[model samples]
Target: MMTDTTQSRGRVEIDDVVIRFKGKQGTVTALERTSHVLEPGTFTSLIGPSGCGKSTLMNAIAGFVTPAEGALRLDGKPITGPSPEVGVIFQQYALFPWFTALNNVRFGLKQFGLSKREEIDRARAALDEVGLAAHADKYPQQLSGGMKQRVAIARTFAVEPKVLLMDEPFGALDAQTRLVMHDLLLGIWRKHKATVLFVTHDVDEALLLSDHVQVMSQAPGRLIRHYHLTQERPRALSRSGNELLEIRDEILGLLHPKTMLADTL
Candidate 1:
């Protein structure tokens, strides 16, 4: 979805990643030998059951969590820790309560050392891209849940991170709002050209928004399958073609126990 110039912004390589956590039950393997490469500026989604380490892998990419054994590289450089070039958007709005939407979005730009005017200009442009320019003066408490998420989105893209890691960003929205956010996300993604790795449990959402959907198995997660979607952008579930439905069914068969049972019957 990226233009030629910004196409080089996002390129990621995950090599033989293994993640583990310490629990009362002992060491828990969250992910095992999982690896993948995301091409520059591609929109990819990770879909799987809860606790299957989809978020764990995302956190690893965001530099929030370290892989017990593996490597993560962005643009051919090893990712040692969180950097301005990588941005994250969680399911929670995570907006500062005291800050206006405009200020919240502008906060990340301070790291760039832009003068007061330049920071405001970039932040305004980001808000405009997400259709929230008019609401810029509103605080998070004054905005709806959907609007709050839009501001979060505006904040992430304002700094133009090379890679955007989204952890179920629209999971908290209602059905109608989720659909609206899908379109909004695609528009901004195309415009910014940041390599996007979206994590979602919703099969339709994954297929609708991604160029490729990677499916992970239950706990001790591994890359079970990956589907490359052929549908054009601005996609809607109702208007999806038969091919899309077929792929959806196939992914469903892998993720849903009942569907998997029926497949063998």
Candidate 2:
């Protein structure tokens, strides 16, 4: 379990943030005056339609895209650029093909100035957490898609980041593999207690993994609803009761009103 002091470290305050992109047509607004706070050590998921700017909002928080109109603060400090304090995982497993799984995990640790032995030990432990310690010597090409993503996750967590930004990290995997990854991620989150902001289009996925699920509108995305789930952890798809089903229906209705209406009729 994390100490109280450490548990208090990852609060993210998004203050009326607006993001824009310049194109041949004109300046297009991606996010429109969005504001929300992710409590320390909590798991929050962002869900929306495609092109709804879910990734854009997450990228702004990661410091990869600067907000045009508002500020993003982490524990009261402004986020100006990418820092090791914030770790990002994308749908693509961004692993180096040449490096072994262990080396890839150790790469981020190198910047921390840990001794060689300590780095190796930490990297091995991270891989073990993700059930990949046995495959530590394998190169990315030798691994399956799931294994590659596991390596990417191990690499990110090896550095002990305060906030984890995952944008559909398991979207590319098969259904079974994605379930396994979900379990691995929940275990890691329970042990580390880092604030997590995950982006996904799956309503069940958001409900299964998140303490809070934020739904966004279509283009020029804005946060439309926030659902706080108070259910027990280790939730299974089979155990989605009436309450969860109702919430799921509401979210689906929000995302696809016409389809939901047609089904209702």
Number of the top-ranking candidate, with lDDT as the measure:
2
Question: What tens digits encode model 1's per-residue C-alpha lDDT throughout 1-265?
Answer: 5345543568899998899999999999999998799998899999999999999999999998899998998877788899878899989989998999999999999989999999998999989988999998998999999999999999999888999999999999999999999999998899888899999999999989999999999888989998898788878767878887777878888887565545553
Off by over 4 Å in 2: 1-8, 261-265
TM-scores for all predictions = 0.93, 0.95
Kindly give the number of clashing pairs for every candidate. Answer: 0, 0
Clashing pairs in 2: none
What is the lDDT of every predicted structure here?
0.90, 0.92
TM match of model 2 to true structure: 0.95
Return the TM-score for candidate 1, rounded to 2 decimals. Answer: 0.93
Model 2, 1-265: lDDT tens digits are: 5345643579899999999999899999999999999999999999999999999999999999999999999888899999989999978988988899999999999998999999999999999999999999999999999999999988998888889999999888899988889999999989988899999999889999999999999989999999999888788756856788788889989999778555663
118, model 1: CA deviation in Å? 1.9
lDDT, model 2: 0.92
